[model samples]
Target chain A: MLELSRRRFLIGVGLSGLAVASPRLMAAGSSAGEQTFHSRPIPSTGESVPAIGMGTWITFNVGGDQYLIDERTRVLETFLERNGTVIDCSPMYGSAADVIGAGLDKLGAHDRIFAATKIWTSDGSETREQAATSERRWGIDRFDLLQVHNLLAWQEHLVTLKEMKAEGRVRYLGITTSHGRRHRELARIMETEPLDFVQLTYNVLDREAEERLLPLARERGIAVIVNRPFQGGSLFRRFQSEPLPSWAPEAGVGNWAEFFLKFIISHPAVTCAIPATTRVEHMQENMGAMYGQLPDTSQRRMMADYVRQL
Target chain B: MSGATWLSYSLQDFVMFGPEVFLRLFARINQDLWPWLLLWPLAGLVLPWFGRQAAELPRRLAMALAGLAWIGCGYLFLVRYYGPVNWPATRFGWAFVVQGLFLLILKGRALPGPMAWPVAVSWWLAVLLLPWLSVLEMPDLWAIALFGLAPGVTVAATVLLFAGQPSPLRWLLLMLPLVWSLFSAATYWALGTFWLMGFPVATLVLLVVALRFNPSPAQNPGSQSVHRGPGRQSP
Candidate 1:
């Protein structure tokens, strides 16, 4: 009986080890293979962004304690190693910009970052001050993209951004809104304002952007950044039990999150889709969506129908 | 100072002539749901904190309040901004139902053990169905039932399965706020704005504090190690 129990224990340990190691092994195998970049042209400049961008909204705000600080540093290192260029954060995100600054400093990756951030305050003076503070925090001389976040103080900030752009303090000036709330205003802004980019929500679950914002962006030659491809956590929750649809393979989506994200980026207007992830594994999966064929118009419709059916 | 004055004046004027401002804003816009969307994370951050003091009761009240707030906000926005469009009443109702189930499952006496599949299943079904129906336009009830509800329920179920006797899933489920922090970040990032970024950072700090200040394992019945099946025990 003792011997039998000992054998059982050994077998259990072996099985558990295998279960844990299998994923790591698969990951290693995948990484060992060749790496590639999937490029999309910026509508305004016709320059290409590497499709995948790192969002630092929650993940970058790692401060207060030592352990969290350490974890955040690791996350930053992982992000840089993954070839992610676009680092999106804002002053409204509670030290996110500051933390990311520190992370970039630690990783020595500041120059590598495609720094994208927003001015959230409504007052023009505050907007200018915040924009300056963001620059100081990130330790950058010029911002790649300075966006008016959620249309909050958009007009006030737009004038400031235009001035900054003219003075060479910012490379691009744009406005962003998520949640399909201000597409019409966004459209007007797109029409009148000489915006280089427009960021908004676009996911399989929330495709309201498709009806107008996307076409407007395309027509106006504004680069599009898709936010909320997962609908916060709603998409993840929805796909938890459901197997990846068979059609996912055709679109090069290895997981459900990618399936949703790839669908958004597949749009011609989308220069990049920023999907924030805390876990390294999730970031890797999201990056995979950047690779492979994005659905063409017909494929996008088909994909949309498939997701709707699910 | 003059800039601040002008800003306040502009906002006050905008508020005073709300109808005109709405018309002007919506003239070219297809729909304006931005203000309504801001309430989601605002409710998420505020409700949990307000309910923190009352423990389970406060949580339940907050959930109900949030549900009501969402419905009311949606209605007000539709009426004020969208102008009596064909809004989906059933979807809004389902959102409240899901929120109710979520609160029930979360606030119940001593977190239900893994055996509480009913609560998990129901909560999952509601969230999946609410969003799928309202947001995604998915029509299949079974797909909503299976996919939407399954992941979170499974996470809870896994926690419950590992939880030892006398310790319900609640203690382990406290890790949920950490997970929620992740989701909140993802949501904000996906939404492409920096709002709600503070909540996750605050939650993370709170979690760290709770971990530090909370009583040691000897004092808590739920601290016992969970046993796996057939001679297996967690390390």
Candidate 2:
């Protein structure tokens, strides 16, 4: 009996070592070489998307520099190569939408992309106009998701978004806020509004959402798309130097990027985590989180505890 | 948002683009305006020679060159390049053109006295040394941001060119530099590209020194001598 138990322990250790060696094999969740990313359902429609998405806040706003634009296209290609779907942008993000359009035009992958953008004007009556402009920039007939950015004129924008949804111009409608601003107001919207998704800031460090907004999202049957999953790159700046905890492999975190991203997407309320990156390697690292084993409740507590101590 | 709510935000929240894209603007603009880029620094190099002349036409020509620099930068760099990434740059670009027009239309004259040696050194530093600063940071010849082409260097040198001019015109012309300095500083700080922050800081410093050393008519008794050249009209 002693020899049998020892043999089982050695096998477990060998498998864990192999998992650390090839994250793709580990992400497959089995011995199969084919990888599978975790997908979460839109409670309203039952449609689902991979838990990892790309954000275009600063990373994609390359403007008229054709060189930079081409570089961004490659980043998009890397994303699509990995089967990434949801890509979120905003008009307030300057030329990001246009750059994305240019990239999509080059790749001709508009059909495969789940284009998500925001209506950011303060004028409540300009919802349709803003959406149209965004559509023109994205070179798409419709946006998969149209969000009232930062709850700006949310009431009026929501009404128009609903109209557009009925008109088949937008697939989903939602509201967004970031840096943990206006949570009380966002919570009110989540409680009262007919939202398909709610995007907000939630990461390992920024846990204020865990108290109310996240729980409310789950209760309202609203999908949650997390923004600033890396807290605008501050998470890596802070935690990159620290050693990954012994249990990191158990949670399937290969590097700091996956470590931070997996924590957010692993949350039951989060449908996806949009972590923006300018580098193709970082995108690959971020998408790696979509695969692999997610931490359970006890392991999550342990993850948070380790970071707080650091 | 309330003040309490505003506290939740930080500088990174307001900044959309990273330093890589911002610094690459120099290389991109340099490629777009090659050969013509040389004229800007040439215009900058001759301004002091014009400033030394007692003739009003030379001084006026100097101001016109400065005006052209502003318009060129405003159009090429801000409007065509930076505006796409940062939307508000377009409005600032138009304002720069207006400032350029002001420089072109305004009469120019030599200062009543020789420019302070320190102020001369600062102007030379801005024109000669400032463009290479970006090269030091980016380590590329194309990344060199020249005066009259790059806003930070152009604004810095302009404050010195108009140093001998009488205000409220001097103060009026200096306003944009001051604003640009603060705005650029904030942007660089938020992007965590502390190296580029020096450009705006240098502009602000030169602005302060120029304003201090070159006093206006109300402040200096000898200010009247600036209007002593041929065809000059006294206020």
Candidate 3:
């Protein structure tokens, strides 16, 4: 099993998110042993990160509840153990950033994770202040990625984010919009601005991004982080009751989680897919997508058609 | 953003936490305020009795106690507890403290018109029945959202207790509760906790009815029987 420490892993990977089939990863299957997950590189920097990352939106916003905090800590542990990195959060998510900080503190796994949060204040002047506060909240020296949340004051924040990136304060800087919002503005930003990553909503069902943004990211050599990969858990509500298609195994999808996640990460342009979950089992299932065979273009089409029919 | 763009989002999009996390707030707050939790129910029970008293001094003292409850609920529950999960809750908590001060310092006679027996029964319902709803949902005794402690129940019961106050001051006092009803309603609805959603919706209904069903001064018992001196007319 490949159980490399965070520093060793980063050094070994050398920021290449390109996939490599590991005999160790395949051999460690269905066991407590650490397994290798597929990683994709940041297009600009060639920094590799696990294609399947955890999202701390509602899942990690457990507030001051000690029990819930402890529970989320275990989930974070599960994600880290499975070789998952690139944990994404936002200041807009109430206590999510705080809870991530708490979970990191409890697990002492800060070094093992890629901490990405956003600057959400509408005041452009407060961009650095907000980032400073988020740094304290996450208990991190600096953020790996900082994005303008929902395009609020994007113009002003983008200037600050660029400066921070130049000063080595933030590893990557970008802008984000979710629930299929502000695509025109986001696309325009991608075209005009120099960004390291762009976060947007895309799932098997919500494929509006496929028409433009995904291709645009590929064309621009900008990495894409897909949010709402499960369509806020609605896809499961719609499809969980149904049986998997007979060809599901051909795509290496054992459950609905892999079925949903593999579709997103399989996209050549996608750097990662962030699906938030509160359960350890669910986190395990989500991390499972980072391994196994991703769907080819034909398989991808078949998977989409199968979901569409169902 | 266009209306079509804005309308595309759902209520759940705004609510960032689940019922599992939200309901535990009651248990957490209850545990934090153990033993002192006894005072909330005591304040709830005694408040209506003071409303019925002919003497303004007893009513003033009762309102002061109720004011203390608001301060406690707002600061301890809303600010320290719920605010961590919901940012708007901190602002609402400060508003609750202000409402508490209003109850403490505002003229007691401004809250003329003793609560009718029917309204008083509803007040009892808020005090006795509503808190248990949390207990039922979480199936934990520690999850009880006691009156004068939980914002939802406290706001509901307060709406009923102050139903008889005159306008302007009455509106001023009830404004936070009314706004709270909307916030709670949206929150609960988004969380898909319909059972918890009913409390805020009921508070909103009670507010509408209380403001609309104002009886004439001649028909009011508190106006005719309670002291209606020239100096005490304005809130």
TM-scores of chain B alone in all candidate structures, in the order given: 0.30, 0.88, 0.87
- Residue A281 in candidate 3 has what lDDT? 97
* Pairs of residues at least 3 apart in sequence or in different chains that clash in candidate 3: A15-A46, A15-A47, A15-A48, A17-A39, A17-A40, A17-A41
The fnat scores of all predictions, in order, read 0.00, 1.00, 0.94
Candidate 3, residues B45-132, lDDT tens digits: the string is 9887876565677666767777888898899899998998888899999999988987887646555654555666677777888887
Write one digit per residue (lDDT tens) for candidate 2, span A1-310: 1122332344345435545766564342221332535767788986667688999999999888788899999999998877677899999999999999999999987766778999999999999999999989998877889999999989999999999988777888999999889999999989998999999999989999999999999999999999999988888999899999988987777898988888898788899999988889998899888776777788889889999999
List, for all models, the DockQ compared with the true complex.
0.02, 0.75, 0.81
Worst 10 residues of 2 chain B by lDDT: B226-235
Work out candidate 3's RMSD over C-alphas: 4.5
Give each model's whole-structure lDDT: 0.55, 0.82, 0.81
lDDT for residue A236 in candidate 2, whole number 0-100: 91
Q: After superposition, how far is residue B197 of candidate 2 from its true place, in Å?
A: 2.3
TM agreement with the true structure for every prediction: 0.52, 0.90, 0.91
Deviation from native of the Cα of residue A17 in model 1, angstroms? 39
Q: Write one digit per residue (lDDT tens) for candidate 1, span A89-126.
A: 77756546766777778777666667889988867778
What proportion of true contacts does candidate 3 retain? 0.94
Q: After superposition, how far is residue B191 of candidate 2 from its true place, in Å?
A: 1.6
